[model samples]
Target: MTEALAVPRIASPEERITSIIALASSVDGVDIVVAAHEGFTYSVQALNPEYEIYADELAAASAVYLESSWQKLTGNARVILADQGGKALLVADVGEGFTVAILGERQAVESLLDPVRRLATGAPISCPNCSAVLDVHTYTCPSCGKRIPFTATLCPYCGTASPARSCPNCGAELMLAPGRVEPAKAEKQRSAVAVTPRAQSNEGEVVSEEKGETPLLIRLTIGGGVVAAYYASSLLLGIDPVIATIVGAAPLAASLGLILTEKRRQ
Candidate 1:
């Protein structure tokens, strides 16, 4: 047994990065974890199955760009938080050209700051809200009975206004107020009103055409009668009556044919 010596295997850079991401994914509510170095994506892990579709987006090199841009803007920012509707993004620069990103619910991502920093940098960072308890209480919509965030003033699922201004968990008074209208519904109503003028103008044009048709017909009939009377007077002046009758009826026949064709096409 002493003839052979054991050799320890060393993990590659990609493997090391993957292991870091795997550790980060152990936190509750964390959906995706991504690691990148020097503008190159090393690994992407989706912890939540429902969030697998967005994994490709997190693996892009743009994350590195975003980290650099944030550092430039803040002049020494190590961590960044961005809110994306129902979800949020947390990017931390763990030094040594290594950057880690986390995507999850807003409250979940906020709670992950200290743990993520400690795992990635071997040192913990201070966060003012890290010690505070996260708001995990959800409100039930009166209309749809769907559970929504405690801070939500309007139910996104049913567009109903929240009736309670107190915490559902501890029955404490909250500073939230009822929202007048849902933003999405208001935008849709504005768009519908914006197109109403165009639709009304189109209908007006149709009505004007319909009303003017009778006047046009009356004018054409009167012109044809006048032409017939003029030709009938020519017969008294010694012109052939049959020729005069044909000449007077020719204009009226052509007008009728044109009107019929237009109506058929319409």
Candidate 2:
């Protein structure tokens, strides 16, 4: 009775990833599951057994491309969903560079998004009032009294801003505002406002930048006319073809330089 107790074995990274893949694949409409860490494929599984041959390669390529794009697009994004050829592709970034990719029906993949996000972030989306797990996809709009997905910042049916929602479990008011604004998002918003057209005081008169340079269509037409005139002069007036070509290119070159300089200034 006093025998030594055996310690539980800890699962390896591969095992953990494999388990997560298996869990996702078990969902009804899930057809394939792939797990990767730091752009390296760890496991690949599919409902159809015949896909074993190229699954690993496909998973590796997908992980690399997705990881790169994810870093460039949004550093804090934990989940991404896309549809291609009627199949849904879901990529979840679990913490510490671990990622899981699942392919299945759109509805099924969307349902799994929150669960995967919870697993990766270790933070469940709970109701602010009652601490109940919130299902964003099944949110009920208070204004429209209709159930709809609350993926964006507004209720689609009534066009009401969703700063809060009623908790489905406890019927209590839950705040939908994010706890903190991300630096990148905040900066982007600020930049957008900064770039907005504004009136500037010039000699006590308001000046606006609304009037732009020559229209692109007119510029192109003028350039084409100049070039065509050069060619025509070379043919009809018997001017040296090489000299005509050089003279014709001068105006076009100047126009291009001005365009580039304007773009750089802007």
Candidate 3:
């Protein structure tokens, strides 16, 4: 009979971070660990039990870290790194920052990069507002104000009431408009329309988008007004019979353009 070999099991990133923290506490320096993904709040922690912080405070720290590294991280990715002579570890990321790294004696957490990277690649984030899958850095809704989390609800700056938590456009809080189920559904439909390809034979309803008044109409109206004014002035000056005809023609041309433009758009 062949002797069975014992297989070594790898520790998960969370486990590794915990282990590193324990060791760092017993030695010199502080350790920090962070983990963030879609639908998950950013977090920060100090390894030493003596270093206590409130949940809100930790969230603030994590948010700061995420904002600072926003430029460097990938979407739905995770990362883990250490500072303070391996005494601190920061696993920072939102969607793409789902990394778990340890900082300690270099020998204690060697070769952690590969595992952390793998974990990040395997785990993606879901949007908190709509539960749609999203990348780590996607703070704005891809469907709405193109802004997500920040603009759904009331305006953060103006303290205005909005329907959701983030804005659809600039990610500003939605205040002027109500975000009910119907509006949200419409927005979602619009986004779908943008991405979906159509087949010539597959009939679908063509939704009309609201647009500003036609430029032609504006021009025509302005032209007509100008002509009327000129004709009145000409009458006051006793100009020739041709002046009246030209004025009448201008108004007629303007009206025609207005009607045609409106009909074509409709």
* Candidate 3 lowest-lDDT run of ten: 132-141
lDDT against the true structure, each candidate? 0.56, 0.57, 0.40
- Where does model 2 exceed 4 Å of error? 1-19, 64-77, 125-266
- TM-score (C-alpha, index-matched) for candidate 1: 0.35
Q: Which candidate, 1 or 3, has the higher lDDT?
A: 1
Ranking by TM-score: 2, 1, 3
Clash number by candidate, in order: 0, 0, 35
Q: Candidate 1's residue-wise lDDT over 99-169, tens digit each?
A: 67788876557655544434344332111222111122345567877555444566655577764444332
Candidate 2 overall lDDT versus native: 0.57
What global local distance difference test value does model 3 have? 0.40
Report how far residue 96 has shifted in candidate 1, in Å. 3.9
Q: Per-residue lDDT for 233 in model 1?
A: 79
State how far residue 96 of model 2 sits from its true place (Å): 3.1
- Which candidate order results from sorting by lDDT in descending order? 2, 1, 3
